[model samples]
Target: MIEDIYEYADPRFRNLTLPNTQLERLYDGCRWAEGPVWFNDGGYLLWSDIPNQRILRWTPEQGVSVYRAASNFANGNTRDQQGRLVTCEHGTRRVTRTEPDGTITVLADAFDGKRLNSPNDVVVHRDGGVWFTDPTYGILSDYEGYQAEPEQAGRNVYRIDPHSGEVVCVADDFVQPNGLAFAPDGQTLYIADSARTHDPAAPHHIRAMEVVDGRWLGKSRVLAQIEPGIPDGLRVDVQGNIWTSAGDGIQCFDAQGTLLGKILLPEKVANLTFGGPRRNRLFITANTSLYLIHVAVAGAQYP
Candidate 1:
């Protein structure tokens, strides 16, 4: 008997994912797969194989190829307003941007004159600010990055001023902030704390914060708690729904943070993003493979 992958908690979730549709396994053969980002302009998807220390690219025309070999153990990636590739490097312990000409520019590597622990995930705000999470996962072992002592006082979320080039800590109370994204309206930010991966008493939920004046974060509230696994990379759909990666698969939450449904996969999902021409294709990075499924929603495009 075939296992059912869709778990519908509400009637609306039935409309998001089709019951007859099949989830496609695109590629595999990685120690740890993560950070799937889609580029519509190129009609391809890029992701990191952290333990392999390389970034992989995939297209419908071509199956999979090495995008960057010496990737410095990159973790997360996103495109800026200018279409430049913004990435978080674990081995280097910094956030960087790949220019249009393929040149690399160091965006943020230290805070308060102290070296960063390890940049985990990143996203670009509508205001052109580069926001990212600094966690110690990369420095805790030699598997993904060089093991070393942390320099910063805590794992925090930071924002880089697009004009001034100054980095500021936006949130500093997280045990390990992993993934983040803004709502379609750009008025709210959702960040995931996967601290439960290290401590059972830590948060295993995602928090939603109102964007204050497009700069600061207002009072945050727990949006949803993940079970059987912690929340990792996340994305927001054009309809304002949140799609987050969890231990089992991807969890779908409505705008109000209600658990709508779940897409259960065989492997633990690390990250996900919407792609394809209409942005209806959901691309996921699981433990050692990349998966895709056609959904009824489109991803919110940031400017």
Candidate 2:
């Protein structure tokens, strides 16, 4: 019966999902949920409730609890190489790191002497670099973050050096960069442009580019174009497969950017992450609820 939730575009996708496992609705009541990060050591998961301005924690032992209130409208979250939680705050328009002692460290907030437009999604490189996407969604209205004028000339993707603490712009040509992820080997970077969120004629595709010298990027090419919705957040598996959020549910693509399959849900999905002990549990954040399902493959990002 669980197999009924999936639509296979490619035969390979059938091997990625399990038939016995059923999709579970973990919880609901969130205004908007995003940014799921799993901690293996603690056996817990943390995600953002943007409109509610809180970060909710979930565990198999205990259902759900408020991890941090007044979270500054956190959007995307990931863990650095050091295992510290790295977060993108829409309200503060900055990227931050949560230390073991529970204190927050500001990693990046501005570039070229101007304040950043709002850091959306973030990812950490194995080499200790902090990368994030800066878009104007947080400043466009007061629902998620405060309504204000964007200070940056363009939405850009930035990388914060591990050793120098220097912030550098890596990509500058995007209508609205939302989610981003790195390949297993950290050689290729994938970014989702959700410009169609406002303008229907804008791009609605995920771009793939070469990561040069851990700082610079090569020419980008459209890896996959989405329809019926835009790509919001995405994650890559060990095989270099990409799983991204869509209007209907989740769209999966193989390394070559081929449509592998789809996980269908009743509500539109906002973001997703792979978790569980084996990193095979796909945790999804939809409009106002959270869902989970088991997968056959493990996520490239480990605990």
Candidate 3:
């Protein structure tokens, strides 16, 4: 008999349980949804609607509200070690940090005197440096932001040294690098290659690279090959499981690349973040609607 797709589970683990509850859609009617960041201090979740050029906030009481208009067509967002909001702006093609007082500080905008293509996703290192992926996806169309001429050669990942203010390319060879996340241990970096958008035959897979002496090394290995829809953004759980957004739902995979569980959703999930009072709530940006679910796992400490 053929294996049941929805009933399938990895053989290595068996505590999976499918929640009967449907995803609670918080708000809808967004042109395109991306970048989910959870702020525990404010008891709310924030995400970007790229085509709308706005960042939206959602709380249990207020439902949803506009956090900021003309958000530079922001893509991915995360909190730094100091709990400050770090964002990747497609319109500005730079990475910025939002201070506690609401001041915006540009972290990185150019490399070698040329503007970046578009900042995609970002993560902060323990040493205070910011790393992000720069791909041309945002500037290829007017849906997310105004189309602009390419300013860089190839899509690459860059690191901004907090102390020196120098931006360096850490990795360069990806066709269209998108979401990125460091493993809980900080020794591994996971990057989602959405290159299929440029090259139809290109494999859409999540690749893992080893970090050595502040540089990415070793052969890039395929962590997972997304089907139906490509992987956009993702986060790692405390237990080292990767929670990635796909067309079908949020897919979870073990550190060894074993598919563990999946949280099915009605719409295509763009990105997600773990937040809530206990940091166990998974806030998902599924197309226009935002959904939340309480999970047993906690988000990685550095995410």
CA deviation > 4 Å runs, candidate 2: 1-3
lDDT of each: 0.93, 0.93, 0.83
Which residue pairs in model 2 clash with each other?
none
Structural similarity to truth (TM-score) of each candidate = 0.98, 0.98, 0.93
lDDT of 2: 0.93
After superposition, the stretches of candidate 1 with alpha carbons farther than 4 Å from their true spots are 1-3
Each candidate: how many clashes? Answer: 0, 0, 0
Candidate 2, residues 28-91, lDDT tens digits: the string is 9899999999998899999999999999999998999999999999999999888899999999
Candidate 3 on 1-303: residue-level lDDT in tens? 113223235643234332443456778868888888888888988899988989999989888899999899998998888899999999898899999899999999999999999999998877777889999988898878679988898899998887898999988888888888888988889999988766779868899988776554456799998876888899998888898988788888888888876777889888988888877788888887888777766888774
Better by TM-score, candidate 3 or 1: 1
Better of 2 and 3 by lDDT: 2
- Candidate 1: lDDT of 105? 99
Off by over 4 Å in 3: 1-7, 11-21, 215-219
